[model samples]
Target chain A: MRTTKVLIVDDEVEFASTLSERLSLRKYDAKAVYCAEDAFAIARSNPPDVVLLDLKIPGMEGTEIGKIIKQFNPAIQIILLTGESENKIISENLGKDISDYIVKPVEIGELTKKIDNAMKEKEKLDHSKGQP
Target chain B: MRIWKKLMVGFGVYVTLAAIIGIFAYVELRTITKRFTVVEVADDITNIILEVRRFEKNFLLYKDDDTFQEIKKYLAVLTDDTDKIRKEIIKEVGTDNYEMMKNAIAEYDFQINILSKNFKLQKEFISKIGVLTRSIEKNLSGDVLNSFLIVRKYEKNLMIYRDKDIYATLINTLNSPKFATAEVNRYRSLINGLFKLYREEQSSIEKIRSKARNIQTFTEDLSKRERANITTILSRSAILLLFAVLTIIILGTAVNIKIANSIATPLKQLEGITKKIATADFSKRIDVRGKDELASLGTAFNQMQDQLQNTMRFLELANEKLRESRAQLVETEKLATLGRFSAGVAHEINNPLAIINEKAGLMKDYIDMSEDFPNKEKFNVMLNAIFDSVRRCSSITHRILGFARKTDITPEAINLNSLVNEVLKFLEKEILYKSIRLELELSEALPVIKSDKIQLQQVFLNIIKNAADAVEEGGLIRISTGIKNNTTFQVSVEDNGYGIPKEMLKNIFEPFFTTKEKGKGTGLGLSISYGIIKKLGGNILVKSEQNKGTTFTVEIPV
Candidate 1:
């Protein structure tokens, strides 16, 4: 099986670090950053297979970051992770090529399941794009 | 009835009294004037006395039959005048003086009659002497007869003159020696008889004059007394008039004051009550005690005051209720703000908890895959505890998000039983852990209702969760669903637990009204559910009895 490249963007350093480490142990290539700028930088250099984004970031809004990510790489799957269920932000980004959303304090098992679903949906989209 | 009429009536009473007094005074004045008329009769008596004296003098001078008849008429007139005066005096001054005057007039009349008879005798004597002298004339010498004629002339003069000196001169002449003794003796005899009669007649005339004077004096005194009596009467009448006027004034004033007080006292009381009402003290009432207009007004005023007081009390109660409702609204607003705020905070906390949960899972995996690991079981248990707490926290944050999410309804055709089942699935574990028996009595072939699925799900979830919380171990919660006349779906959640107190049941759905302990309840569950159900055009009802159980019934249109 090919390793999944996962990108994490959050302003909370410990949360970003711990989440990235947990994802890496789960046998995926996960990288974490604390701001939207770094997230964009990492995404443009080495495009991720799936992106995990926090609804609240330091400088830029979560929905704007999401738009930027999809614009940069349309094939990259994005999943939203939020400390609070800011329904406005979640629903706004849901239309912007977001694959799924999960309220925070999510169990690892559940997060893994969502990640697998997101990767599958991305592959299907890629296949369809390649056919046309 | 009206204040003006009352006062006018009071004044009218005084005017009537004054008119009465005026009439009495007029009558008294007339009586005094009438008595004065009787006093004027005194003037008639004095005039009669003067006329009687004048006629007497005329009779003495003329010595004719006409004079004599006129003198008699004068005397009768004098007597009549005296009698009239006496009668007047008796009428006015009582009978005591009338009798005295009557005696005086009678004596005067007697004296006048005597005087008249004596005059006649004297006349006869004079005529007889004349005849005797003529018979003796032829028997005397010429010179003696002449002397005799001279003496006779003197005697006639003396008789007419009625003078004593003249009579004496005539006697002396007749007694002279120059005359014959027989001739003198004859004349002297005749003279002696005439002298005696003349003296008696003179005395009687004097007596008549004296009696007339006495009557005149008495009449004058009687007239004076009558004048005095009239004066006395006039003064007394004036005094009585003054007294009557004074009595009328005093009595009128007293009555006027009484009438004014009767009217004014009630008016002042009404004014006082009005002032109290103006100041917002509506309890004061007029205490009038009689059945006049003022009393009736007081009764009406008291009725008005009672109504005003009742209205004021109603207003106060309404204001109190309004304030309580306003307080409730403020609490609802605070809860809304807190719901949003806590949702945000919960989301923020969820991120870190997720991180911890993931890290702990990663550690557990690492320990399980490693060849040699120290304290593996202890690490596994600790990591499991971390996972467990994180999962618990996630449940709480998710539930908070459930309520905080915008409740804008998205309607869909949904089966009521399926919806209720979906909501109960969330609380299945809690029910098992508490050992509570759950029963579902969902009716078969229930039609799908058109409503918001997520909102109804939340409503059912809240009610079922409250039921779970209310029950003890082995308690039963029965959830039933039904189709009501093919138009609506109804769901009832009943729990056999310690029931809600009757007093608090009414307020249970009000914001922040809670029965649970602090930290166990935000008290927003039922309140939010009620609001959502209401917004969805549904109804929720509750029935509970103390120490028995509670039932919440929800109905939504199909």
Candidate 2:
């Protein structure tokens, strides 16, 4: 199994820490941040292979944050987390991003599988670049 | 009674004057009549005295003794006549002095008889003296002259007797003696009696003259005094009458003013207040001025009007508040209905969008990784499904936007009867499926009404839906169109179905006041319909009785 780069971004500090620790055992280089600004900082610095974005964030909230980060690198994949059941927040905010969503209180193993799939996607890019 | 009092004074004065004057005049008339009768008696006495004196003159002045004897007979006749005059005079003048005058007259007659006897005896003496002493012619002349002188003396006695009442003189002379000599003493007694009579008569005349003076003086003075008193009384009575009349006039005017002011002032105030209130203004009140019953009555009337105005104001405010509350409630229910609808859309549209998104993302990955592979049918279904979900979402948003729009209608010519017929046609299948018999009494050539067509259609649809829900099998809904006024058209939708309950009737048009089961009716249909109808410059009225039917009448002015 190859190493997978996963970014867990949420304003819940304890939640992000616990989730990142769990992902570490699953062989994912998972990091966490409380805000879109820090997430962007970390993304530009280490550049995570896949971003796990929370829809509600303190600064530059997830919907617009997804757009800005996608503009920076469109090939970089994103999966969204939503705490609210309001369709307006879903359709109006996150609909344009075409990002996949998992309602919160997700299973840890299910998150790990999502990260593995994203890493494979990154690997295909690397192998293609090597062949070229 | 005032007249009685006034006439009382006049009658009293008249009675007093009549009584006093009647007595005074009676006394004066009696006295004057008595005086005249006395004068006539005195004149007769004087005539008898003169006749007696003339008889003595006839006996003495003639030289014949036979003539002298005839004169004595006449003297006796004159004496009886004088005695009758004295009795008649006494009967004529009714006084205590009547007996005095009568006695005096009898004595006068007695003196005349005595004088007549004396003259007869003296004549024989004179004839014998003429025979004794010769110088016959001179002696006859002397005898005639002496007889003439004696007759002249008797004439003087008669004048004195008549002047001083000889009858009274004679009677007084017989009663009191003053003469003293034999023949001369006999003559002296007669002469003394004569002198006494004259003195007594003179005293009586003096007393009568004094009485006449006193009576005349008193009557004349009293007449002047009484006249002055009556004049003063009349003037005083006149002043009192004038004052009484003025007092009556003044009091009458004051009473009239008091009555007019008491009535007219309050009445005028009431008229003004009533006029103001009749125009539906209730800002002013009348002050009750007097504590009289009528003033209290005014207070009560004003209070009643005040209460009526207050009640009217209260009703208007309550009705306005009710309308406002109904609007708020309609808005709330509208939001609630939108929430319920969106919830369904979220569950139905969003989850499918999620599936489409997942499949689309997988498709993109398959295409990216395996360049030679193409799953055409699968990708097409996925893309089509995604497109369809998106389209449904947009349509749902459009429906919500259209339903929630608060567009105000600009009025124009509309055929209300056609609008009603169109709505009924749109709803006829629903009505027929529900088994509600529809009746239409559309008036031909109905005038065009100025109103909102969409709003009218919604109202008709909602009312028909409500009627369909109310009626069981064999129920009827009748729609009638007519002209209400020159500028108004009326449409009535009547249902022979279960009517609204009396208590619920008041809140029928209020939002969320549905009698339908939960989730079947949001209860805002009627409220929104009513609001729309009202906004379109029209009125919707409902008349219903429980268990009988319901009727909705819509009036829209042209």
Candidate 3:
């Protein structure tokens, strides 16, 4: 079995780093960045199977970053991470390039489960495309 | 009395005085007329006396029948006139003088009669002597006849002139001895007799003249005295009449002035008060005096002024209330806007709180993994405290966002009693923990109103929860629900707690304004409930006294 690669994007550097380290301890390949530009650079150089994106960022919206990363690699799955529990963001971006969403103060176990699920979903799509 | 009655009374008095003056004038005029009549009678008496005196003088000179008749007629006229005005003459000239004048006129008339009888006897003696003298002349001649003729001529001269010398010559001629006959002697005797008769008649005429003069003097004096009396009476009546007229005028004017002042003084006061009322000053009152119409009008005016003052005060109070409510509405709007802005800020703050929470969780995880770490339990405890603080921060942010979010109302029929009971049910545990007395005075007849039930429950829960929290141990909290008015229903929560200070009362509805100790309150309960009530088309009001209690009332339209 291959380890799942997860990218974490957040304006809060400590939150992103701590969450990434926790995911790394849980046996998932995880990286963390503080801005949309670093997130874009990491996505282009070495893309992850799943991305954890904070909705509010410094320059670009997390949704916009999710769309741009999806364009770069269609197999990469996006999960939105936000401090807001309102359903407006989820309903707006749920079926578009986003796999799922979670509110912040992210639990390490829940995040890993979501990342594993996104990787599986990407593998399912890639398998179907390879066969076709 | 009424004003008109007073004027009528004054008029009545004036009429009475005028009548008195008229009567006085009439009596004075009558007295003056009587005096004039007396004076006329006096004048007539004086004229009659003068006419009698003129006739007496004519009779004395001529000794003729016509003159005697004129004197008698004038004396009768004087006697009649004196009798007609007898009382007036007596009043003026005394009774004794009037009677004396009457006697003098009688004496003059008697003497005229005696003189006329003596004149008749002389006429008879003259005729007899003429016959006797002619016989003697025929019987004698020469010297005797010449003497006889001379005697006759002397007799004729004596009769015509009535002189003493002629009488002496006749007597000498008749006494001559040339005719020594018996008939001649008779003629000489007749001449002596005629002389005696003429002497008596002269004495009577003198007595009549003195009497006529006395009567004339008496009548003239009487006339003068009566005229003076008439003049005195006229002047006195004029003075009395003038006094009467002046008294009437002065009295009438005084009465008129008194009545006019009685009426005009109140009217003047009314005018002054009316002017003050026009200026919108209603502080002054009318001093009502009499029971007259003007006094009653003043009383009514005072009542009107009182009403006006009360109405003005009421309007001022209403205006002040309107201004305060308008300012409150503006504050609510500002708070709403602030609430929206704070929601965004709350969301922004949540990000950092999430970071801090994650970091604390990470530290705790590392400490748990390190079995031999120094003071690892203390480190875990500190991290747990940070985690708790983060949890508190997140809860506050969530509440801020809830307050700013647009609420979707699910309108349904709600019983206010049941709603209050439900809120109290939520606060029951806190109430039991504090040993606070919970009193419910819910009205059974409360009508079911159409409102958002969840929002109303949140509002009631917040208010009643505050009441429970505010009270001391075993203190009282009372929840009551009732219909406030025709269009709204009310629910009130009262607690005997340390009430909010007066200075802090205005800011109680502001977000994050709390009197509770740090960490004991998030301060968003009442503000969020206020926003909910406002959104539900209702009002929340609070009343508090320091150290006494606080009561919060929520009024929602039916």
TM-scores for all candidates? Answer: 0.57, 0.36, 0.57
Q: What is the TM-score of candidate 2?
A: 0.36
- Better candidate number, 1 or 3, judged by DockQ: 1
**B1-558: candidate 2 lDDT, tens digit per residue:** 232343454455546545655665566556545444444444444554455445545543453556555545654553454354454334444444545444444454454444445445544444443342223224345654454335335534643444445444533442343212123233334444444444544454454334334323332333343445445555665565566555545654555466556767777888888898999987778777766655876899888997998899899999998997688567556555654565455434543443344444444444544545467656667765765554445434333333445454656677877788788788778787887788889999797777666667777888878887887788998989998756777888888788988888889887567888764666767876776765555678999988888998887656
Model 3: per-residue Cα lDDT over B280-324, one tens digit each? 888678889999999899989989899899999999999997986
Poorly placed runs, candidate 2 (over 4 Å)? A1-132, B1-398, B428-436, B443-446, B465-475, B482-490, B496-527, B539-558
lDDT over C-alpha atoms for residue B292 of model 1? 82
**2 or 3, greater by lDDT:** 3
Question: Which candidate has the top score in DockQ?
Answer: 1
RMSD of each: 11.4, 18.8, 10.0
Compare candidates 1 and 2 on TM-score and give the better one. Answer: 1
Model 3, B423: alpha-carbon shift in Å?
1.9
Judge candidate 3 against the unseen true structure and give its global Cα lDDT, from 0 to 1.
0.82
Q: After superposition, how far is residue B374 of candidate 3 from its true place, in Å?
A: 5.7
lDDT of 3 by residue, A1-132 (tens): 588889999877788898888777778899999988898899999998899998878788888999999988888899999765665667788988888988766665677788888889989978988999
Q: What is the fnat of model 1 with respect to the true interface contacts?
A: 0.68
